[model samples]
Target: MRIGLFVACITDSLYPATARATVRVLERLGHTVVYPAAQTCCGQVHYTSGYRREAASLAGRFADVFSGCELVVTPSASCAAMVRTGYPRLAAREPRAADAPRVLELSEFLVDVAGVTDVGAHFPHRVTYHPTCHALRSLDVGDRPLRLLRAVRGLELAELPAADECCGFGTTFAWKNADTSVAIVADKIRHIGATGADVVCALDDACLTQIDGALSRLRGGVRALHLAEILAAGDPAGDR
Candidate 1:
């Protein structure tokens, strides 16, 4: 399958490895991954921030960029949810509205569309997964990520406490509601610490960033890693 890689803004700028790992895993599966340079933000922030017109413009551009691909995959669940759910709400009458159903989160694409869970990955670490709100509620990608993680050769999957709780990174919500965001993230960090996991993995880098910041402030040893990064580890070619 020819898959169009929608490297969301956060993955492109802050977590490029996530994008590379996504490509690595897809290519490992013998699928052609195409990067459309024209692709930008899925208009999620704009849409959530009450800029419907601006969000619609971006959604239109997103559709044009990946219109030719058979499938569109993104590592960030928030971005995938934005394209899948937010785009239609932002511009139902626009041509880009038709592209909503074509977008898939990485785990969804792997487990549902690609029909494969074992991506031939290996990682020797005690890891806990945080289901981003967008992945859990918006995309309903329950257990697909965990399924893939379980299939990894050397990964020790630890169940996170209160796994369904939000990480307090509601995009701009962090800026507008700093105190509440900090308190929520503090609780999240406490749960992560209780797991004694070496790494915290999630489908959204934005959430990971929020968690990582708290970990750094507390001088915690735990590392925040994207799901793609964890899967990208132990590549036979040592490319990752």
Candidate 2:
């Protein structure tokens, strides 16, 4: 399948590895990935922080840039969730000429479009899952990620407590409300620590950053990485 890779601003700048891993995972599964050069921010940061007008304009640009692709896929569930859920709401407020539901998060696009239940990757660690709020609530992706993960060879998936709760990073929420953010993440860290997992994995890179921050600050011995990074390990290109 020919897929359009929607490399959001955060992944392109802060976490390029997630973007590269996304390409690796798609290519490993025999799909062609086309990165639209005009792609920019998903405006999730703006939208979530009460910048509706700016968010709507950015959403239009997002749809316009990737309109040619048969299917649009993004690794950051935060960005994808913004496009899927936030865009529709913003689109309705505007003229609605640019609204399109073809865009999908990596979790949904992989399982739904590619008909790929298994991507043939392996991670032999006791890993825990953290479902970032956007991926779980906005994108509504639960089993989609787990289904692919369960197929990874030698991967011991541990059940994390309160998997559906946010990691306290809703764009600027972490920085704006530092104390509350730290507190929420502290609770999450305790849950993952209880699981005794070597690392915590999730689809959204934003959550990884948030959770990793709290884990590091609290001195918890756990690491966080995007789900694509885990799956891309199976690719012959080598892990990033």
Best by TM-score: 1
Ten-residue stretch with the least lDDT total in model 1? 92-101
Model 2 lDDT tens row, 59-115: 878767777887888887788777767777887755441555377888887788888
Task: Using lDDT, give the best candidate's number.
Answer: 1
Question: What's every prediction's RMSD, in angstroms?
Answer: 1.5, 1.7
Summing lDDT over every window of 10 consecutive residues in candidate 2, give the lowest-scoring window: 92-101
The per-prediction tally of clashing pairs is 0, 0
Off by over 4 Å in 1: 99-101, 237-240
* Residue pairs with backbone atoms closer than 3 Å in model 2 (clashes): none
Which stretches of candidate 2 lie above 4 Å from their native place?
92-97, 218-220
